[model samples]
Target chain A: MMDFGSFLAMGGYAAYVWPAYGAALVILLAIWIDGSRRRRAVDQALHRLEQQRNSER
Target chain B: MHRFANPGRFLRLANRIQPWLKALTVLGFIIGLYLALWGSPPDYQQGETVRIMYVHVPAAWMALFAYLLVGLASASSLIWRHPLADVAAEAMSPVGAAFTLIALITGSLWGKPMWGTYWVWDARLTSFLLLFFLYLGHMALLGAFDDRARGQRSAAVLAIVGLVNLPVIKFSVDWWNTLHQPASIVRMGGISIDSSMQWPLFAMAITFHLFMLAAVIERMRTLLLEARLRNQRLAAFERVGTQARASE
Candidate 1:
């Protein structure tokens, strides 16, 4: 049987520890994704605006 | 709010400030990480794992701080009709939700070794979880309406209502018996921790602040561009009508 102490001592509770690490990873990924999507939206909006400006001229 | 409502003006200022914000965030994170990993002594209680406080605590703080920003922005928009206040609030909502999730996850991670449980419904934890819900609610409310203005206005109201939860979350640890630890870095009685812990904590705080600034500026720039596009389309429609009348 795997001892409880041994289990926890494995990377110092890394079994439980992995969740937090995963959480942190997700948070960073969310920030990057949100920023990038917003950037893309801005680019699209600008492209449309550029087309409008030229057509009007 | 009115002062920065002009997109051209806002973009110029943001362009100048983005570089500095980037530099500050990188420098602060480096110093904070160095101090947290190497400079500080381990807790008599938590050992080296205590170092996680440097990131975990500030993120928890930012989760709350970001909402307060949303609440304030919503209030400004509702009151003064700041051109893009709702836009700002909407932009920051996802970022805030992400931070709240990080805080909850990290808190749970720290809790398992110390408290021996992966989950708890304690006051601090419960309220923080609700904080994440508030962010979701705001996001949902914003998209609920086919009319963007109507959607934005409704979300702004929801954000304002959610502001009440911030204080409840902050004081929950003190007001109730909690598995969570109390604040050591920014106590009303002054910081009770040692200098070693304090330095890294301060560094992390600065880094988080700079990170928020960079994210906000980038998001705001995107909002400005979107609004600009909208205005152009409307103007073009008006011009088309005038030419059609002239040709007739």
Candidate 2:
């Protein structure tokens, strides 16, 4: 079995391999976070509008 | 499918499926990453750089898959005037665009190490770049007008027209000489990739699709809420206008 250090080395292609995976991770997480954040913001705005309408009535 | 075209019903279904979908995504990534990083063998020629394919291939596939979806949804929106379809097409544009960006960046990264260049203006790469622009154009059209329906209708037209690029992107590698390799998994003969590599690739592909679906559902819900908010504000404005007229 390869040692821990060698595994991290990725057979000398670590620079290319790690960054590719890292880029995918970042992009995927960004979409997930951005989607949920927009959803939450819109939901909150809708809620506030409804509450204001009720109070006025 | 048409039955669920009602946004309320679709939102309820979305809410129910979300937790399960997220859990599966997390689980799939755990397994997929393990196989991709540890279990899979390095390529004989590409060496450890082949690991990039685990992420790059799935992302490229999703980029195309998402566009295909946007195209189909746009067609439905244009033909049937389904509001849900408009929301769907609009919601998926950014997701598809993000995946396309990932594919481009990672492909470039892989290209640098293997082909000794970050980019080339070959048919496959060029067509894929056009796919990214189509997504941007679709999103831009969606918000171009004050009238939401008009904006959606216009965007739907653009998206349906852009569907022509899908086949060109798919066939470009075959039809032209390019640095990008031709199809390995979906050729007429069968998948050329080894079974050992297929496990992580397929797992990551499935996980990416689930992630895309989850993101789309969330965006769809937001669009629905925004529509409701618009209607509510309009009604409130009308009420105030009526009161002002009565007092005058």
Best by TM-score: 2
The lDDT per prediction is: 0.80, 0.91
For model 2, residues B161-217, the per-residue Cα lDDT tens digits are: 999999999989889999988888767788878998999899999989888988898
Q: For candidate 2, write residues A20-49 as lDDT tens digits.
A: 889889988998898899889988988898
Alpha-carbon shift of residue B149 in model 2 (angstroms): 2.0
What docking grade applies to model 2?
A: high
Please state how well chain A of candidate 1 matches the true chain A, as a TM-score: 0.70
Measured by lDDT, the strongest candidate is: 2
Per-residue alpha-carbon lDDT of model 1 for B81-186, expressed as tens digits? 8876787898788878888888887877788778898679999889999999999999998889989889888999999998999889988988999988777676
- Residue B82 in candidate 1, Cα distance off native in Å: 2.1
Per-candidate DockQ values are 0.37, 0.84
- TM-scores of the candidates are 0.86, 0.96
Error in Å for residue A7 of model 2: 1.9
